[model samples]
Every structure is written in C-alpha cells, then in structure tokens.
Target: MLAGKVSLKTVRSFVLHVFVLAFSCLMIYPVLWMLSSSLKEGNEIFVNAHKLIPSVWTFSNYAEGFKGYSGQSFMVFLKNSFIVTISSVLGTVLSCTVVAYGFARISFKGAAFFFGCMMMTMMLPAEVLTIPQYIFFHKIGWVNTFAPLIIPSFFGTAFFIFLVVQFLRGLPAELDESARVDGCGHGGILFRILLPLLVPVLITVSIFKFYWTWDDFFSPLLYLTKPEMATVALALKNMSDNTFGTSWGMVFAMSIVSLAPVFLIFIALQKYIVEGISTTGMKG
Candidate 1:
C-alpha cells in the first residue's frame, strides 16, 4: 500500500514537472526569438523567420541605439527613466507601506469602511480617471512636467497599499506588543521592528513599482511635451516613428537592453515574492 502511494506521488510530480517545462518553453520562446531577431540584420529577419540562429549576428544595431537616434539620445532617455523609476519606487514604497500599516495594524473608527473604499479604487480602471487626472494636473499647472509623475506617489498607490497591508497583517502581533512594552511608539515599532521583518514584501513592492513606473509610456506621453523630458519608454516609441529609414537593428537592440534590468530584479526576488504573498492569507 505504501509503495503504491509513493509511486502515485512520483507520477504526479513527474507530470507537474513536464507541464511546468512545457509552459516555461512557451513563455521563453518569444524572448529567445526576439533576441535573435534583434541581432539579425533588418533584411535577414523577414527572410529567416524560422532560423534559431541569425545567419550573421551584427552588433551594429545595438551600437547605433546606444549612440543615439534622430534628435533624442538613448543615454539621456535612460537617465530620465532611471530618475522617474527610482523616485517613484521610493515614494510609492514609503508612502504605501506607511498607509498600509495604518489600515493593517492600527484601530480607528471607520477603519474597515475606509479600507474598503481604498480597495474599491483598484476595481476602477485607470482609463476612467485618466482625463480627470489630466484636467486636475492642468489646473494645478503641473502639465508637461515630472510633477504629475512624482507627486501622486506621495499619496500612496492603492494596489501597493493593498499588497503591503496583506503581508503586514500576516506578521505576528507579539512584535508590536513587545515594542510597546519597550516604550516604543507606533513609528518606532514600524521603522525598527516591523520594517525589518517586512523585507520580502518591501522588495516585492520595489520590484513591481520599479518595473511598472519604468515602462510607463502613457503618463509621460500625456505630460511631457519637450523632447528633453521624454522617458525611455516614450523615447523608444518616438524613436521608431521619427527615424524613417533608420536601422531597425538599433530599435531591437535598445529593446533588449531595456528589458534586462527588470528581468534581473524579478528573478532575484521571486522567492521572496512567493513567500510574502502566500503567507498573507493565514490569520495566525
């Protein structure tokens, strides 16, 4: 009977592995194809769609992309992307984490009702509020600037707050009580004790916020009128359109380069993400 059970478990594990491998290939194939296409000359790509190996891999496209395209410089756009991504990530993490603590740990009148409203904000799509945000920013003279990009992060984003609140609620209550016994206020407990334990969730939030803000095109497109203010995402979009008869190689090269950082960060923190997200559902 035990042998039969063991055999069944092994079979189940094998099937799961096979399924995972198949799905992994399905997901990874496109990335592999894109990398190959990016390295291939523009003319050869259409001709050799099935080729796993580029007939002749040329670094020229990537080289040109880095050097600059048309009027916009890739380096400048990269710098702008870094600034927007880093600033927004920091702002969102700090603001969202603190607000989440308020909802998760603190007891106040109407707290549950207000938290429900906060969650409802996520249910509404951003498209519904896009025009309203644009008009509000316009009235405040924040149009065509980074203020629209940076300031909203200070108030705290709904999704990030929700994620963090879940994770914070999962942590043991003993730590908060211990801090209280030590004469530490809520701020000290949050900053000193809880924050240390919340590392996994924090990293998870940072990874997500960084990637989303980095790749964000619409917000920058709506607000940034000047070419100098263009971010990496918008720069990529405009670079393709503006550079007529320009090298497609450079475009692909820049795309690959842009994709690398987010990929690395996600892979590094995937384990923490799984743990932090999973533990949230258990009340104890």
Candidate 2:
C-alpha cells in the first residue's frame, strides 16, 4: 500500500511539473516571437510570424531604430526617460515615506479623516482626474514640460502611501519610544530608527515608480510636443509612421530595448519585492 501511494504521488508531481512547464512556454512564446521578429526583415516578419527563429538574422532594425527621428537620436529619448524616472522615483520615495509615516505613527486632529480621504483617492479612477489635472497643469504652464510628469510625484501617491503605511503599521511602536528616550524627535525616530527597517518596502516603491514612469506613454504623449523632449515610450510611437509604412522590425527592436531596464531591475530585486509584498500585511 505504501509503495503504491508513493508511485501515485510521484505521478501527480510529474503531471504538475509538465503542466507548469507548458503554461510557462505559453506565456513566454509572445516575447520569443517579438525577439525573433526584431531580427527579421520587415517583409519577412508577417510572412514568417509563426517561426520562432528567423532564416536570415539582421541587426539593421536595431541600427535604424537607434538612428531615431527628426533631430534627436534614441539616446536623447532614453536620457529624458531616465531623468523623469529617476526624479519621480526619488520624489515618490521621499514624499510617500513621510506621508505614510505620518498616517501610520502620528496622531493629530482630523488625521483619521484625512487618511480616509487619501484612501478614497485610491478608489477613484485615474481617468476621472485626467481632465481636471490637465486643466490645472495647463493653467500653471506645466503642460509642455517634464514638470507635469515629475512634480505630482512629490505630493505622494495613494498606492505607495498605502503600501508604506501598511509596512509601517507592522513595525513595533517600541522603536519610536526607545528613540525618543535617546533624545530623538519624530524626525530622528523616522530617519534613524524606522527608515532602515523600511528598506524592503522602499525597494518595492522604487521598483513600482521606476517601471510606471519608464513605461508611461499617455502622460508624455499628452504633454510633450517637441521631438527632442519625447521619452522612449513617445519616441517608440513616433517611430511608427503609417503615413509611409510602419517599420515593424525597428519597432520590435526598440520595444525590446525599452523593456530591458525594467526586466533587469526586476530580476535584480525580485527577492526584496517578494519579501516586501509577503511581509507587509498584503496577504489579508
């Protein structure tokens, strides 16, 4: 009976492994196709769309895509994207941490009410605020610049604030008391005691900020007009000229390039991301 049960368990494990492997291949096939297409000639892309490996591999798509449009190279767009992404990440981490710490640790008049309002903002759809934000930014002369992309991040975001708040709540209040006894004020307690412990969540916040800002297309499209000021997302869109003909190979090449940083960052910090999400009271 024991031997029979062992054999059944082994068979079940083998089946599960096969199922998971098949599902992973299904998920990865599109990316593989895109990578393959990026190396193929424009005409051959559609004709050989089903093929995973190209018959004639070429690097000209990457060359042409990097050559860029108008007066700027793809490097210029990448630089603009890096500037916006880095600045936004810094601003988000700073603002969100402070705001979340306040909500989590400090108590004052109307604090609960204010926190409730902030939570409500998360429930509100971003599309609902688009018109109002555009009007406001336009009135302030921020419509045509990176200011529109970078400035609002300084005010803190609902999701990041919430994440940090949850993480902060999990931390023991005794740390704050101990810090106070050591002549540390609230700022000192935050900076000296809590911040070090909050590294995982901060990394999570940074990862979120990095990817969102890097991948943002709609805001850049809505605000930026000059080709020189375009981000990678906007530049990729500009690369596709349907008026003449879309360069499918170049588009695919640039898309692959655009995805590189996000993939690298995620791979490098995946452990921290998993730890942060798992331990930060998100499971409930």
User: Each candidate's TM vs. the true structure?
Assistant: 0.85, 0.92
Q: What's the lDDT for candidate 2? A: 0.90
- The Cα error of candidate 2 at residue 148, in Å, is 0.6
lDDT of 1: 0.83
The alpha-carbon RMSD values of the candidates against the true structure, listed in the order shown, are 4.8, 3.1
Q: What is the lDDT of residue 207 in candidate 2?
A: 87
lDDT agreement with native, every candidate:
0.83, 0.90
Pairs that collide, model 1? none
Model 1: CA > 4 A from native: 1-26, 273-284
Displacement of residue 4 (Cα, Å) in model 1 is 22
Residues 99-121 of candidate 2: C-alpha lDDT, one tens digit per residue: 99999999999989999999899
State the lDDT of candidate 1 residue by residue for 128-219, as single tens digits: 98999999999999987788998789899888899889888889999999999999998998999999888878887887778788889999
